[model samples]
Target: MYIVRFLRCLVLLLVGLATVTHARAADEDLERVAITRALTDYIDGSAHARPEQLRRAFHPDARLLLSRPGTAYWPVSVDEYVGWFSGAKAGQPTGRIGNVLSIDVEADTATVKAEILVPSQGARFIDLFLLRKLDAQWKIVAKTATREPSRRSADRVLFVLSSAKFHGASRLPAGVSFGEVVEAWDAFRAAGLTVDFVSPEGNAAPINVTEAGEFRSRFYDADLMYALEHTHAPSQIDPARYRAVYFVGGSNAIYGVPENSRLQDIARHVYERNGGVVSAVCHGTAGLVNLKLSDGSYLIGGKRVSGYPEEFERQDAAYFKEFPFLIRKTVESRGGTFLTSARDQGYVVVDGRLVTGQNYLSAKQVAQAVVAILRKPADQQPKQAAEKG
Candidate 1:
C-alpha cells in the first residue's frame, strides 16, 4: 500500500513539475514577443519617419550615444530623435531599411543588435540597444550605433518540406530526399545564404537517405538535424524575411505541400511582393502547380517547368496510386510548359524568377541558378511588378 501511494505521489509531482515548466516557457515566449514588437516599432518608425512609433518604442529618458568623424561623443535624447521626423509624413519611406539581427533578454532587461541600411548613401550602421520591461511593456532605455560600408543583404531562403511520413492512406513510408536537401543546402551555403525549413504541420520532416558518403556526412550534422527536427509552421514564417522559397522534393512532397494554401501564400509573397525567387527540384515542383500571382493568374503560366514527370513513375506501384496528381499533368493544366531530359539526367529550367529542376541530380544546379540571379546587381536583377493580392 505504501509503494502504491509513493508511485501516485511521484506521478503527481512529475505532473506538477511539467505544468510549471510549461507555464514558464509560455511566459518567456510572451516576453520575447513583446520585446520583438518594441524592436520592430523602432526599426519601422525610423524607416517610415514615424515619430509616434518611435515615441512608443523608447522611454522618454532614453539616450542615443553616437560618434561623428571629428567628435568623440554625441548624445541625443529621445525627444531630439523624434523631433528629427517632425515634419515628415508618417509611413513615407525614408530610403532607410533596418533588420533586427539579434536579441537577448535577462530577467527584466534585454539587449538588441540591429542593422540599418541607407542604400541611397551607401551606408550601413549597426545599432545596439538596451531595453527594460517597464509597466509590463518593453522600451528602449539606451542605444549606441556605428557605421560601416554596406555589405550583403540580410535576406534568407526558406526551404519548404512535407510533414507526411506515409504515402497517402497506405503504410508505405515516404520522406524528403536527403540527397536533394544536402546538395541544394551546400550550394546555397557556399554562396553565403541562410536557409530555414518550414512544413505544413510545423513538425520534424522525415528524411530518406539511401546512400551515405563523406560529402553527405559533412552536411548531416547536429545543427542541420536539429533544424529538420524543428521546422516552423507556415503561420510562423515571415515572408518578407525570405528572399526565396525552395520546395524540396521527395515522394512525400506530392502529399501535403501542393494543397497547403498558407504555403502558397508565403511563396507568392516571396516571389511577387519581395521580387524573390521560387525554385523546386524533382517532385518539389508539385508545390508550384497551385501557386497563383496577385492578378489571379497562375505563376507558372506560359513558363517552362521541370519536375519528376509521370513517365518516370511506376504507375502500377502502390505509392504512385496514392499520388493526388502527376506533376507534369498538373503543370500543363495550369498553363505551364512541362519539359524534361532523359531519365536520371540533370535538367534545370530558369524562366525569369522561377527555377525548376528535373530530378535530384539537378538540385545543386537549381540552387546555383537562384544564387546567380540573387547575386546580380540591383539594376540588372529582374524586377517583379508589385500587385495587391
Candidate 2:
C-alpha cells in the first residue's frame, strides 16, 4: 500500500513537470511570434516613417548594403544610412516595399532574413541578421545583404499549344516530330509551376489522345479538347515581368508557333531584359529562329541549344520537306551552339539562362532544369557560382 502511494506521487510529479515544460514552450513560441510581428511592423513602417523609425529595424551597429553586377560592394553604417536617408527622404519617398522571408531560432540566438520589393531603387535583396539576447531583449547584431535589379520568378510564363491533329509532324514526311502540348501541361502542373496555354489563331489547343496516353495514362493526361474549349490568356504573364518563356509544341506547333509575333516578342523581352529562361522542344524551338534581341543579335546566337534532332525526320518520311529549314541548321547558322542525343533519345542543354529539351522524351528534364533556375534565390546562388570553368 505504501509503495503504491509513492508511485502515485511520482506520477503526479512527472505530469506537473511535463505541464511546466509545455507551458514554457508555448511561451517561447508566443515570444517568437511577437518578435516576427515586431520586425514586420518595423519594416512596413519604413513605408512612410522618418529616418528615426526605420532605425528600429536595424541595430546601432547595423549596416546597409548594395551590390551591382560588376562594381565593388558598397556598405553603409547605420548612422550613415540614417543621415543619408534624412537628406534623400524627399526624393526617396517611401512606400510599402518589403517582405519577410524566414525567421530561425535556436535557444537564445536567432537569425532572421528578409526580402524587400522596391521600385526605382533595387528591392531585389535578401538581408540576413544575427540576433543575440541582451538584457532579455533580442537585438540584431551583424547584417549582410545582396541586390539584383532584374531578378525573381517570371513576372509571367505563358504556354502556347496547337490542335492535337497531325501531332508529331505526321502530316509531313518521316523523321520530323514535335512536342505534345498535353504532356507539357502535365509536366508543368506536376511541378507546381504555373502554366497557361493559348492557340495561334486564338483557338483552343487540341490534345491528341493516342500520343498523350503513351506518356501519362489517363490520370496524368490533360483533357486537351476540354482545355482548349476554356483556355484563357494567363494574367500572371506580362512580357516585362516574366523571367522565363516556355513554348509547348505539338506536331501542330510547326504550323502555329513559327509566326506568333506576340509570343516571340514576349520571349525576346524576357530573355534580354531579365536574362530569363526561354525553352522549346521539337518544333517549338522553330518559333525562336526569327527572334532578335535589342542588339539585333539572334536570341540563340553563340549559346548552347537543343531541340528535336533532325534524325526524328525519319520517323515521318514525308514531313521533313514542309519545314522551311531543318531545326539544327537554322539554330547553328545563327551562331547558336547546338546539342543533341542519338536519334529519338533524351537530350537537354543548359546554356547560361536558357534550357532546351531535344524532344518529347526530354520534357521533364527541361521543366526540372527551369525550376532549378527559378528556385535558386539570387543571394544563395551568387553570380560567381554560376560561372563555368
Candidate 3:
C-alpha cells in the first residue's frame, strides 16, 4: 500500500511539473510576440513617418546614440528623433525600408538587431536596440545605429509552400521539405537577399523533416518557424516587391499548390510582369506545370526544366498513387523539356528566366542561379519567353 501511494504521488508530481513547463513555454511565446510587435512598430513607424507608432514603440526616456565625423559621441532623445519625421506626411513614401534581423530575449530584457535601407541614397544602417518589458508592454529603451554604403536592392524573394498536411483522402502524412526550404533560404540570405513565405491556404505551412543535421539545427529557430506558421496568403503578396518566386517541394507539393489559380497568377505576375525569376525544385516543379503567361502560353513551354521525375518514385507506394499528376509527364505535356540527373544528384536547369532543380540536393544551386540573374543589370537579365502583353 505504501508503494502504491508513493507511485501515485510521483505521477502527480510529474504531471504538475509538465504543466509548469507548458505554462512557461506559453509565457515565452507571448513574450516573443510582444517583442516582435514592439520592433515592428518601430520599423513601420519610422519608415512611414508615424509619430504615434514611434511613441508607442519607444519609452519616453529612450535615447538614440550616434557617431559623427569628428565627434566621439552624439545622443538624441526620443522626442528629438520623433520630431525629425514630424514634418513628413503620414503614410507617404520615405524611401526607407526596415527589417528586424534578430531578437534575443532574457527574462524581461531583450536585444534586437535590425537593418534599415534607403534605396534612393544607396545607404544601409544597422540598428541595435535594448528593450525592456515594463508594465505588461515591451518598449525600446535605447538605440544605437551605424550607417554604411550599400548597393543591394530592396527587392525580396518569395518562397512558395503548400498547405497540405496529408496525402489526398488518406492518412499518409505529407509536408513541404524542410531541407529544401532551409537550403534555399540559407543561400539567398547569404547573398544579402530577403525572403518571404506564402502558401495557398495562407496560414501555417506543414513541414516534413526526415533527418537532423547542421542546417536543420541552425535554421530551426523561433523566427523561421513563426514565419512558416503565419505564411502570407496569395492575396497579401505584391509580386512587384519580389525578385523571384521559388516553389518548395515534398510529398505535399503534389497537392493544393499546382492548381491554385491565385498562386498561378502571382507567379505569372512575378515572372511576366515584374520580370522576376520563377523557380522550383523536385515535386515543386508541379507548380510550374500549370502556370501560364499573359500571352496564354505555358511559362515552361520549350524550356529545359529539371525536377523529380516520375521514374524515381515508387509507383507501387501508397503516396505515389495519390499524386494528381506525374511531374515529368505533366511538364512534357505542357511543352517543357523535362530533365534530371542520377538519383539524388544535384542538377539544375536555367532556361531563360525559368529555373528548376532535380532534387533537394539542387535546392541551393537553384537559389544561387536566381540570385545571379537578379544581381545582373536590368539590360543583362534574361529575356522573358513570353512577355506580358
TM-score of each: 0.66, 0.51, 0.76
Q: Residue pairs in steric clash, candidate 1? A: none
lDDT of 2 by residue, 153-189 (tens): 2134566554435534455322112234555555665
The lDDT for every candidate, in the order shown, is: 0.85, 0.62, 0.86
Ranking of all candidate structures by their TM-score, best first: 3, 1, 2
lDDT of 1 by residue, 1-389 (tens): 99999999999999999999999866766787799899989888888888899789999999899898898699999988888776846668887777665666788999888778786676788899999999989999999999987643455899999999999999999999887888998788667566789999985788875432434674447557757776889998999998899999988999899999999999999998888999999999999999999899999998888999999999999899999888999999999999888886888888888899998889899899899889887577744421110
Best by TM-score: 3
Is candidate 1 or 2 superior in TM-score? 1
RMSD of model 3, in Å? 5.3
Q: What global local distance difference test value does model 1 have?
A: 0.85
Worst 10 residues of 2 by lDDT: 380-389
List runs of model 3 lying over 4 Å from the truth: 1-41, 48-75, 86-95, 100-114, 118-152, 212-214, 219-226, 383-389
Q: Worst lDDT window (10 residues) for model 1?
A: 380-389
Provide the clash count, candidate 3.
Answer: 0
lDDT by residue (tens digit), candidate 3, 2-66:
99999999999999999999998777767877998999888888888888887789999998897
Q: What is the lDDT of residue 359 in candidate 3?
A: 89
Model 2 root mean square deviation, Cα atoms: 18.1
Clashes of each: 0, 23, 0
